[model samples]
Target: MSDTSLLSSLLNLITTATCNLQSELKGAGLPEPWIDNASLHPWDEETPSKKYWDARRTLISALGMMTAVVQNPREKIICDDLGYHHSAALNFIVNTHMADVLAAPNVDERIGLPVSEIARRTGTHPAKTERVLRFLCMYHTFQETSPGVFANNKVSECLKKGHPTAELPLMWADVGFRSATAFSATLRDPQTAHSMRIEDAPFGAVFGNHTSKSTSESESIPKSEPGTASPVRATIFEFLSRPESEVYRSAFAKTMVTLDIMNGALGYHDLPWDRWDKEGAVFVEAGASTGHLSNDVLSVVKHAKFINQDLPEVCLQGEKFFAENNAEAIRSGRVKFQPNDFFTEQPVKGAAIYILSNILHDWPDNEALKILKHIGDAMIPTSRLLVMEIVIVPSLSQSRSPPSAPVDQNPNDAPWPLPKDYGIVNRYPHHQSMEMINTFNGLDRTLDEYVALFQQSELELVEVHRIRKLVSIMEVKKKA
Candidate 1:
């Protein structure tokens, strides 16, 4: 439709609403400026009449106000909610198990299977499965790259088990199972919603071991084999394995990768490698693991040495990844990987360009300061440090296309009686991100937060860039 027609339609809708309200108020027998002045615009409340235009004014106000409210939103959630279920939504999440179905590595189109086939393969009901799949595509949860098939989104990718989007789903799924089996609420709180908080948990409360409850009712079952152990026992064994299990270690790596991604991780693939000097300065990535992007940097900055460093476990992963890559690279001879603990008092020398990716948010004020001081001490007086982290915007109120929901809590909930910065109230991400970080000793910081963190670390921000559009990259130099 043309703009003129669209405008005419809207004008008609408004005219009808206004006229209806005017008639209702006139009938209410209210004697007021409303009745006397048909010419008075809604805003002209300056002159009052014997009967204040209460009814007409209020009704018109609502009509006018709703316009502003409606126009503010980006996407209108369909009034009839989609029949999409939890797993249906999750399975559509990026890079997780679900991707295996809707898409294979090479074929990006719809899997061309009937509902029965899809259900049989995924173990879902035919009709319901088809409905959910089609429904998510409606909201762009996944795109129907081909008819009856789906592709990913930044939104969905952001929700992967490793992303901020991954937390609530994972947390609720794990705890929700326990709640269901509670069968009748063995405890109290018969009236209110169940409230429990898991904090500082990276990767959004994967529960160190998030798995389903045992279906086998064999209560007296003993450890016939450790592999057959119950979930609780398996959890205990995971802990017993202590940072060694591939699962636990993967969770750790996944969490950092997600954090870095959220904090605007800029991979080596995205860098202007053709322009960067290979030997200009070796890029030392502190806490780099698997060298996923660091290796890309090495490839790009051929003259620049790429150093990927992290803890022993991550170092091993990096070494393994590099070694695997090296088997191919050695034939071509490029890029090197080094293993070192940043915390073990190694002098930060020779590295002209140091990178800290998604590191500061994990520590509290004092500890973060200590790490910064270590970086400061190790840095050459003139060296530069590139620190990447999420800078909390003071009020997320503006971020909302239509603004936040009424129940949405304020970001700055005013910590006690202290000043905002002193209280650190604003450094928090949304409650969703907070839950994941709080499960562990991690946090999301603001610009002021980055400054405070940087000052402590003996680095001063020279310029800050919002990389990948979302992650804040701080170019810092040693404090003069």
Candidate 2:
């Protein structure tokens, strides 16, 4: 295809997708979400129908491609260089509570808060605050109603103090920013590049392990098996548990809550909960921090009991959370907290279902194998292990049309002009795949990779249920 023809094809795709999305919204009697509005669109407040979701995904995918194709190559490369600057500016805005100041009840949305006032409230320099707001304004985050004055727009409102997505920016900036900046260095360094050890990840490269004990002193800690990269120091999880890292630990916990809200609770909807609904059914969630997933599950599987297992400290926190938020479940003995390490033997044998949500991706194949083996050892013939994770579909594929989704299937195929798996619309898994590498020297895997890993652990992948666009329930059982 000629360059001009390809460009036209892209434009046509964008137009068609946009029209479809708009028509769906209008048909549903919903207002189209606008970037400039401070209030969330009605659709944002609730889940949309499947048709609406498909249309919206199509539009977003096409638009993302159109953006890349239209921008000059040189300009795109230059702009990409300042990705770090964008992160830094956003970090500054969030850390200084700029969004909170602008969204305060007394603050006028039209007039906006002056940079001086915002700076005073946040204890920052006025001139510096203005520059950060202006930079963010260019990206349609905060809006500048007048020179040196800013207010929360739809994009910025999510970062307000108590908003659902407020901790996302904080988490990404504090946990990921430096690691991302040091990506090249970590990969280029011979010591870390080929290493599969979690301790050798970009986080460790940027900020060497903070734990005081040496590797020799910490023999009780889990070590990589032969052929796996050995730990040079403590991993991020261990560091987060230290008494001195209390502030970061608190922030990390809140960040995870925001992460859950962003990921939604629908990922568990498609699983075969009915089959296990008999009385005395047990669901054990490994590495379950604060038991949020299990709590959500309690609402769905009324007859099943849930046990949330995690580190001792996190188990304590989960107990408090259950007491305050799900007292009835705890009081009724339907939900319980167990402090246990997944690396050790499986304590609760023959649970009806076991869940390892977003846990395996935090370790490499070798370490992940150990985790799987432990879980597999405890599984009976009827016991099922649901590995809730992203099963990465390639962004580019041979299919030129959306793959057919049978009543029982959730195909991720994309149409022509938009790469398969909906291109940038499906970047969450890819971004998270890199995040795993950056933070833990781990990675997200394709279905084939998972199948191979499960086989090695003496488990079989019996079924797959794509629950959300970015998450799937890989149902496995003990090998026959």
Candidate 3:
């Protein structure tokens, strides 16, 4: 092979290595001290500068391999080991209604549901369930306190759907929407006329549309006209929307309520209300799909107002979750709920804080801006936007410009921003997140892009904090 071809071959090896590591981390178990940082505000997960640098190095090496595949397209494997684990994890949860079964507290070990008994309750082929249980043992999502017996742990508790502590955000992103959309979508068809002008990826077909603008206006956002059929992470209608019946909807709703109650009990431990409170507080869960995040927000904030928003079609669950819960709470009087389609509407005045925790990074800038502009419009002078996100930092080893000017300077004076040379792009968690969100045309973001998004909205970056090892806290204020 030619030297260039040979170099590409070496890079391929690197990509495979990186993907394996990513999967290992996910299966390794959820981060420790998780209960402590559940409501991750800024400054929740602090570490030494050296640790950040070490992690940045590992991230760059991983992402660099993945990005190379984007351009070269040939020398790589799509489903690294992590992809397999993700599927395994989802199947594991679904079979036992793992989330529900786990929520029953000590009932399992208390009843001594050894592998045979667990199989009996779930009504599974006992031998097969035993095989799966052995897999769970390896991951320790459930603990085998004694041989043959299983019970919940911090990680297992989170598996319950609708549990606020549940990273339903993560789970829903994977099996929830992608699986459903893939039914009729052409996820890997890179040969359409639109690939040249990528705006053409069929909305229904869009799988991995992750993108970043030229760090400078000189580096323009690739042009693509808006199209119908936007991607959603997942909505509450899995039960209703699929079969198109009220019974399914009702069942899904009940599941959601059960989830909510479990999450509240498991999640109340790390509510981050004290350390970071702002003046104009509004968190527009733009793709609030069914109001799960809004429910989470309501838990932390009695004073902090929320903008629970999503597509009009998907808005019912927000109402349902609140209405069902509040009916009981009203006699008790606890939380309030509001619904809006954030893209079309969000309150934009005198706001202290606005949040898009698991938003952004979903679209190529082509669509993300419309949502950001709405968020910007809602900002008051003192308001700040708090995003609990996975920000990609640039790789430290890559050579770059000296620090004399800002890393994002423009050569052509074209109007837009670009990624900075900060070496953090790979810090994002869940290697498969890009592939999973592909079902929705949703992409991930780098720290540089977040800065640019804020700039477009005339917002300023006041502070940036890291949550756990994978998530980040970006605090921003409307620019003066």
lDDT values, one for every candidate: 0.48, 0.77, 0.48
Which run of 10 residues does model 1 get worst, by summed lDDT? 414-423
Question: For model 2, what is the error of residue 355's alpha carbon versus the real structure, in angstroms, after optimal superposition?
Answer: 0.5
lDDT of 1: 0.48
Taking all chains together, the TM-score of candidate 2 against the true structure is 0.88
Q: Compared to the true structure, candidate 1 yields what TM-score? A: 0.55
By lDDT, rank the candidates, best first. 2, 3, 1
All predictions: root-mean-square deviation over Cα?
Answer: 16.8, 5.7, 12.7
Which residue ranges in model 2 land beyond 4 Å of their true spot?
2-4, 23-29, 209-232, 397-411
Q: How many pairs of residues collide in model 3?
A: 32
Say what the RMSD of model 3 is: 12.7
**Candidate 1, residue 195: lDDT:** 25
Compared with the true structure, what per-residue lDDT tens digits does model 1 show for residues 1-480? 222333343355446545655565566554333221213232232222212323233334344434545563434344323322554355333223343453344543333345465567666667776676677656655554455544454344445343434543433333332222222332132321132212212222223344432212112322122112223323322432464344434545655544444323233244344533535566677777777656545444556666777766667776676676554542343445667766656444757677777666655566667667767777776577777665666541222122235455343332111222222222334542453232423567778878877876667898876333234577788888
